[model samples]
Target: MSISPIAEPFYADARPIGPDGRRIGVLLSHGFTGCPASMVPWGRHLAGLGYAVAVPRLPGHGTSWQELNKCRWADWYGEIQRAFDKLTANCDQVVVGGLSMGGGLALRLAADRGRDVAGIVLVNPAVHTERKDVLALPVLQHVIPSLPGIANDIKKPGVEEHGYDRTPLKAARSMLAGWKQVRADLPKVTSPLLMFRSAEDHVVDPSSGQIILTSVSSRDLTERILEDSFHVATLDNDAPMIFEESAEFVRRVTGP
Candidate 1:
């Protein structure tokens, strides 16, 4: 399958003189079945500020939904881990961010890597869902390959998220299962955290935000509610707010 131009991964190198004479890196990831296109604007905004930024296209994403069905949660996490390693190698400090499942992946990274992650910024991150249908996934995945997609949930008109039109069942099951482990290791995520959530998100319910805020051990935690957007707030009316506030968060956490 030919990759769409918008789906391509985005990268920006750290400048020699970054925040306080130290290079700062930001690793951003897209959600399940969603491509890097959703994060490119945010990545570019950070890069323009001289931050090394990497937004990786996860395995089975930016491609066909059938390919996504063949992948597991670990496969996506491996890609995020790889990008983090490379970004950290080139910068003195690193902060990780993600949207939806990508946020879950960032939490896993912070949990496993410890203080190496300077901070975390998440937007409508999903660690769990209140949808009862998920209980049928283990059996349904064997019976079906996919369901209708839950992408492009932005309230803004004409804003495309470039996510798969179908939600692969096998992959969905894997993501939900991985949430258990993330929840268990939440205490290991001790880095400063910032999260932005749309008050009217139709995709992720409030339970997800509640779980993260109550579970993570980060002492410096801030949660901001977005009133003018939906699930994909990164590209919606509140995007500028997310970008500017997040950039400020980066400076405060990575500053000497």
Candidate 2:
């Protein structure tokens, strides 16, 4: 009926911090089946650097997989769009980024907003899935509520993403639908782009990143390979790399 009390402890919602003079805003989203816990560190890092930051908890996330099943990709994208609007309301510019499904949502934002979104950064963003099982989701979701989870795919041993343990088929299908929309509009994402892909991501395939790199019309594009992480690289060994480099990337794009 509600979010598990166990997950309550792991839920985090962070907002912008620092001086008003900092005119740059950063909006980040968590992966599918994931809550804000995976991105709190990154959001806090950007906030510490004086950029306004927002990491919103998507609808149906951090609550229950059954609740997530009730949510459509449009619901998730609506939350990101709201957060982005809030960020751009005050800040002179905004940079959007996310992990996994969040990344696809960010891409959608970049495509929709274009010049409004100053830049794009993604870590193991999932735009497409080659899994045959995903093909069965259309029917499986009608019969089964959930399957095995795709959350917390980290290389770090003690770290946890604090996401849903059971993957909701209906919600997964919504994500795939969102991915198709984002991919179709790839040429519309013309902002400067930076992406990091784990060498051994188990959740999103490497081809996901490839499709993005080859499709986006952004004049500036950069790709980095993470040698020491997995799909949830934000919470793993290469987290610092993402934080540091992403901070620099924001500064580079938003300017002094």
Candidate 3:
């Protein structure tokens, strides 16, 4: 069997329209090892509201496991920054949002950009964790080897599961390093934040959500729980909740 699953292709790209007619744009980033495919629905919903949305595939993602392992957090963050800048150029204002690892990057950008970033939305963001699996990255990097697996997690609406058939240790190591950096920098972020946490996320420590709640300087932070979903809550039963809440957040910040 192949060591990595077949590469999944992206269906679209960001398109700019006339500046006078543009709505506020959003840059949506997917979780580690996830493709833009996972965030398509969320992007489509925002676009339906007359907002321009950009979902860029991170480096080494939606391609192959080998490519993913080579990617670091900076690569992912750079991708978001590029997209964010592009969106801002086309629209009057911009919001940044992401799922899982993507959420961490979004927070970092918002924190660093400050007033430049209009708002943020984090879905099951990985903020901080004491989980042994996340900590085992160093040892597993040398001992564990690659295994055949799918790139994305599959969860039905309103269900909970451990997530992914196989976890890539090197990739996990890179992500944890990135999260540590984000944790140290959270205090600087003052943009309004909207965070969604799942009550039954098996992949991340429950306290992960709480860390974000307490750390960020965004006084307008709002927290909600998707009780019926798991880590990938964006795809679970609470997806509509995610859609509604995020849409509302953009509306409140940008004023429709």
Candidate 4:
């Protein structure tokens, strides 16, 4: 598959001058149907601050929606796991962050990695949905191939997420199933967590945030509400705040 130039994966390795004199790494993932375009800017910002950063293009993403339909949750998670492994091998400390479904993937990594994940930052993470339509996905996926697009839910005038124009049902079903597993393992996530949620999100509902806040065992947890952004807060009006605050969070959590 020919990937779009803007949606290409991004990675940068930098030497660290932290208190412990150890390299710090940040691994970021984009949402379902969304490509690395949604995360490359944030990764570049962190890289500018002299941190090693990686934003990987998940399998079946950065291509067509029909290609995405052929993928399952494991395919995406495997790519994230590979990226995380690479980051950990090069850095003394690693932090994970994500947007939307990427957030769920981050949480799953935190849960599985335990203390290896120094911290986590989430923007409009989606783990559960209140939509009743999801209940019929199993039956609907066989009848139809997709639904309307859920990408680019940003309030910024000209910003584009560069995500799929259609939501593939088979892929959606796999993602929803993955969410259940992430939710079940939430108690295992003990790393510091900073979550940025949009006050008026059109994609993921508030229940996802609520579920995460109430379930995770992280002692250092913070949630910031983006009043002006939508589901894709990472590229919206409040993106600067997310970037700065997340950088601060990473510094504090990975410091000696």
Question: Each prediction's Cα lDDT score?
Answer: 0.95, 0.87, 0.76, 0.95
| Residues 164-211, model 1: lDDT tens digits | 899999999999999989988998999999999999998899999999
Look at candidate 1 and tell me the lDDT of residue 14: 82
Error of 4 at 217 (Å): 0.5
Q: Estimate the overall C-alpha local distance difference test score of candidate 4.
A: 0.95
- Score residue 15 of candidate 3 by CA lDDT: 40
As a whole number from 0 to 100, the lDDT of residue 157 in candidate 2 is 97
Tens-digit lDDT track of model 4 for 7-74: 89999996776556789999999999999999988999999998999999999998899999999999
Residue 13 displacement in candidate 4 (angstroms)? 0.5
lDDT of 3 at 23: 57
Best-to-worst order by lDDT is 4, 1, 2, 3
- Per-residue lDDT over 1-256 for candidate 2, one digit per residue giving the tens place of the 0 to 100 score: 5764433322123343435455788898988999888888888788887778888888898888889989999999999999899888878889999999999999999999999999999999999988887899999989989998888788899998889889998888888988998999999999999999999989998889989999999999999999999899999999999999999999899775
CA deviation > 4 Å runs, candidate 3? 1-22, 146-165
Candidate 3 residues 64-121, lDDT tens each? 6666777777888898898888888777889999888889989989878889899999
Clashes of each: 0, 0, 2, 0
* Candidate 4 residue pairs in backbone clash: none
